[model samples]
Target chain A: MPYIDIQNDLPGIRGLMAFSPHTAEPMGLLANALLHHSDGLLAAERELIAAHVSYLNDCFYCQHSHAEIACYYLDGDRQLVDQVRTGDDQAAISPKLKALLRVAAKVQQGGKAVQPADIELSRKEGATDKEIHDTVLIAAAFCMFNRYVDGLGATTPADLGSYPPRAKQVAENGYGPHIFSTSQPAGPSVKPL
Target chain B: MAHIDLPDLPGIRGLMAFSPETAGPLNELAEILLRDNANSLTRGERELIATYVSALNDCFFCSNVHGAMAGHYLQCDMEGIDRIKGDFASADIPAKLKSLLRIAGSVQKGGKYVTISQITDARTLGATDREIHDTVLIAAAFCMFNRYVDGLGTQAPPDRQYYINRASQRAAEGYLDFELYKYK
Candidate 1:
């Protein structure tokens, strides 16, 4: 159960957002910009990085949700998603992506854990400065997201069946206003702060 | 410094050099987080939360800089701030603040590490729900800031006076008006 009264059926951060829509707006905007914006990295690659970080953090909801999105972008390659989650090094992905995943892992451990050589390897593998920066931000942001979901004691539903359909929606629609358009009214009345 | 050919900027400022466009919004978020008075937490308590998380992350610059800021606001000396950072539980502070620190520490480790019992403990100590909410955001934000500084291998000055000087300035002016690029 959530630490506070929240929508019990909604999974992970969705419940928390339902509890506070005011905060949800900015959070969704940031997610859309980071994961779905059509600029630096491909959406699938960004989702892969997010899933990898979620996997490392042991955030079940985030890992499953983003993994489903990754599979969608990867032409329904669920096995490839599983492989990336298990170990990016062994996964049959581009060398640049593997190098980028290494940087993301370092960000997961701690910021200082990322060394100069890691950046060099990524650059050698054709990753740009922007890609590197986005990778770090994505990894760091997920740390906050994962903590928010679990810190509040939000539920991570055991049924994997629910995630794919939602992931398909999120993947197709992007994280916009519709993401928080739920039947449950915003609860607990978050005071403006 | 870590991997990229960044300009010779000092401290965390150097890391921002990699993505100058992000520096503005990132600094804006910091301003809202640390300087804005919309939340229930006092400026001193908020700064302490940032310092505590920075210390936990082992980011030397952030810990020292925010530690100085925390001391300035609390009217405490370095020794007091050091005591709080060393072991907030035993520090000469209120019980409620200590409970919040406990929550911040749990966030530093991982989100799932925080438990319902911890929330209950905080509530028992007279912490309002908004206080708990702000504490979690502060802890989460510091994780990002700490990573941004340390992830790029930005160099932290060794002299404590460097941070003390910057802290005095930041406390007086806040984070908004300050120029981030000139330091390079």
Candidate 2:
């Protein structure tokens, strides 16, 4: 039950579905980047950051899905997941990771919340400038993504395992191969909906 | 410069930091959960979703960092990152992913953005209820994270490698070992 009429007929918040920047093409691109891109942070760590940020925002969808995905990398450690979901950074991870998560948490709360002391501590733990920057970006990005989905009232499946296969495929194929509902191939020339 | 004032450096937004009992604990718990939880979605895919959401929000700081992180799990080309960030539908991703991204997008805007068709479509592509729920949560949470960072005008490091090494370390350590700062 969405509050507004979405041009796309979404399930969550109808208002955002019609107005949010989400579209088949861009969505695919974003997916590819998230799964296929090469960079400093590993996929698992990045997912951890996302889940953490989403939890802070209370974005149910983002937190749940990313958490599921994160499990794939953690050797299916549900206990570890519980620890993260419970806000215990001191569970069983490494000191550097703990430090990084700390900085990430600060970012999720507010950039200004990230203090010089935080940076000094992370650096002491061997966190580099790029790591700090990436963590902040990851936190900031999840915030927007959470708002977009919740705002539009997008439909979500009832089952949780529904995502792994798709995640696996996306992880394997990237974003360029998946298209939805368009009779024509995706391109700039394609008419805007 | 940020539109709001610093939370404590003598400004109106000075009261913005997360309280230990409030968003602080919640966010920390979330980080651990995603890192350790098991269901369906892969850690790489989840990170990718988060990164994409950040990019859509125009949160430059988040987009780059997460982008790099997602890259680490990608056993192949970084081109996937470009494709997803550019256009998901036209990109080379698999069907399940397309649906997941669609769900993630819905969350990014708001939960209401998703539609029955989207869920059905995801299921048709083999997405489960948990997958759908998690995707939505990720999107919703990122919204808060993005706003928190942009709202405060956090500074990002200029070096790319800085993110890489840190990412490598976090990837190996996992979130359970995350530490908290005890300011004196």
Best by DockQ: 1
Estimate, for each residue in B59-110, the C-alpha lDDT of model 2 and write its tens digit. 6666665666777766423466757777988876778988889877766655
User: lDDT per residue, candidate 2, A153-177, as tens digits?
Assistant: 5455444555454444434444432
Docking class of 1: medium
Error of 1 at A163 (Å): 1.7
TM-score of 2: 0.46
lDDT of 1 at A165: 72
lDDT of 1 by residue, B1-184 (tens): 4555676777667756666555655666667667888877899999999999999999998999899999889998777898999989888899999999999999889988888888999999998876787688779878877887787777888887777777777886787677776443
lDDT, candidates in the order shown: 0.80, 0.57
Q: Which stretches of candidate 2 lie over 4 Å from their true place?
A: A1-193, B1-26, B76-79, B180-184
Each candidate's TM vs. the true structure? 0.88, 0.46
lDDT score, residue A60, model 2? 67
Model 1 CA deviation exceeding 4 Å by range: A6-9, A20-26, A181-193, B182-184
